[model samples]
Target: MPSHVAPTTAEVYRAHLADASTSSDVFAAGLAEEPAAALVNALAGLDDPPTVRLLVTETVAKWLRRDFHLASTAADLLAAETLSLRVADGSFANQMVVTADAVASILSTDEQTAGPATDDPEFVDSMRERCSEAWETAEPFDLRTPPRSRVYETLGDEIDPAVEADYQAMLDAVETTRSNGYRTTDDDRFDEVELVLLAGAKHELQHYDLSRWGEDVGLASKATFSRTKNRLEDQGLLTTEKVPIDIGRPRQRLVLDDRLRDVEAGDLPEAGRDVIDSATE
Candidate 1:
């Protein structure tokens, strides 16, 4: 049963979906008007676009974990989709893609297995229709539900092309994975590694001046970050150099090895070449 405590972030979004005055255009415009708060609130009441939901839920959870207070967990159902949407729209930093893809894929599998096999026929039918629509459409899609409508009305207009494309890709991947019925821990690990590679790349590029780029990615803990950094260094995707950040104090700087860059930019390692291929691709 979905929790009803006050109104979760999802419920707030659901309310937006329920309104007749909302539209994607309105939501898009709201982004500039409100930024993070608007983005957060516009996320309310999304029931369709499972990919969108998955991304939103995951982003919300992460935001919450990082102390971005917006109450609710129903978005957990669609966390991955939201992140993908953010990535596509250019609203988020690029580092979130690998993390979004990996987690969203897992959620897609989980949702399929958790589907309503034991529910009332009417409800089952409703869910089935929603799922079908979700799989077929792009963002700002209608779930044939009031709450979804309100959300659309509120945030739909703001979606950019990148977000739209990435979201479509995410949906396609989710559908493909669901149809295959081949879930494995290896898939999850690949995603983890991919995220690590992405973070490492960002660190190497000096995207941020932080001492621990991998740890800042938010998907991995400090220990996991250390492990991934070591793995990549071993694989030659990264190299550590001692640099002077503070005049007296020296710090370790992550440098991207040209060979590794060639590998990532080249076709040397495809996404499914091996367990860790996903990281490179």
Candidate 2:
């Protein structure tokens, strides 16, 4: 149970489930009585269960690409469904707004960085309504053939400018090295490392554990991502720390240094001093 004022997307998803008890307990608890709860359980396999909203969002994405074969339609449906969820009494609605803002933020990363952290609330609120109709039902709603490119054209759009600036600094540091050129065999690895950092930064902001992050980032293996993460730590960009709160295996957690965390929190100006002080402390 999260505090009701604009629960994070993660919290919204979590509140859907019945407790830690077994399925028997869930059935006995009568979660079947609620349509929204039942819909969530039927889709997610647990009554009153917690789920990542991204799961729902991406499910709509996949269905758009594959089943309905209409990428635009799928996006539309998901956007719509998520919107309706927001207006409902459940916390899912608020989470939907957060997810929409995140998507918009990622889409608009190249803009000026010094806003009041409180972005367009009305626009974000509108995304809920606008998006809900877009992804209203998961039924075969494909609209067009998805482009099969692994290197998405939109990748650059998703990169955080702060992360990009930090990586560019790293690139500048290694520019004279024979192995640092984009044409070199290691360049792809470098790109992957930056991507992992970006993904990791988002994870830190969203508070997704590493395993969940791996799933969200669509990595082939959590271990491989960990290896890249360690390489980043070696480069002094991330911290290879463990946390007991991580539901994943021991040594699987990665903590972004305070500097990066500040950037994610829209506190980048303070981030410079904070990062140094925290790292040294």
Candidate 3:
């Protein structure tokens, strides 16, 4: 579920899909109009991408490469998981939606998969009629998806290439440079909290998701993770803000401080540091 209260985001998205005529163009445009709806539709039968990404230990982005089959052997799905880690926000959601739409479109007219199995009695019956010659003469495609370099690169194959390229060029390349450029625990052997903060600073947006790093630091339990975070807050090393979504519970985003970006572990006074104050509350 996207949240505990609301239906999973995918359910809301599936509702929207009802109005959409299984067309890729409609989906592409719908994505532009309602990104959230697409986000919901993306994980489709799955749960909220954001919450799942934050909760799951480290599952691959099976939705990204449109590889829903958990037992897939295609390299694209593996590559998509790697890409998920690098892209900001929810790029994987888009990949899922696009791939599903494409598959639906292809399947609707496919012969082998369409025959008597479907009540329509049209299993790609038109495939030979439509592309027999084209199939024989068709050139082999590079067989690739868009890259992550730009929106066009991510969406080139799915949408009108010209439209994507036109919009892509106009996007401003703003650099989100923090004054605390090298914010880290400067050679200090840090406890879980300090280490988590350091790792967050290295992230693209500096937002820490516990599921992504909890096990690595031995803070797999949310209660412990929260306590550690609170300890860091007491030290003024991190700040947190909650983002409310329609589905699941609001997510608390952890922001590391730039001023104290690089604190030498040994330089700090180790006086009374073991107190935990309501980090999980």
Clashes of 3: 10
Reference-based TM-score of each model: 0.32, 0.26, 0.24
- The residue-by-residue lDDT of candidate 1 on 26-108, one tens digit each, is 11111221123333454443544222222222333333333112212223323434422221122322111011111100111
Q: Per-residue CA lDDT of candidate 2, range 188-237, in tens?
A: 22433344454445344222344343444343245655555655565445
Stretches of candidate 1 off by over 4 Å are: 1-189, 206-217, 247-249, 263-281
Q: At residue 40, what lDDT does model 1 achieve?
A: 45
Among these predictions, the greatest TM-score belongs to: 1
Off by over 4 Å in 2: 1-193, 202-208, 211-218, 245-252, 264-281
Each prediction's whole-model lDDT (CA): 0.32, 0.34, 0.31
lDDT of 3 by residue, 106-184 (tens): 1112222110111122432332222233223333222122222332343344333442343332221111111121223
The positional error of residue 251 in candidate 1, measured at the CA in angstroms, is 2.5
Q: Considering TM-score, where higher is better, how would the candidates rank from best to worst?
A: 1, 2, 3
- Where is model 3 more than 4 Å wrong at Cα? 1-189, 201-208, 211-213, 216-219, 261-281
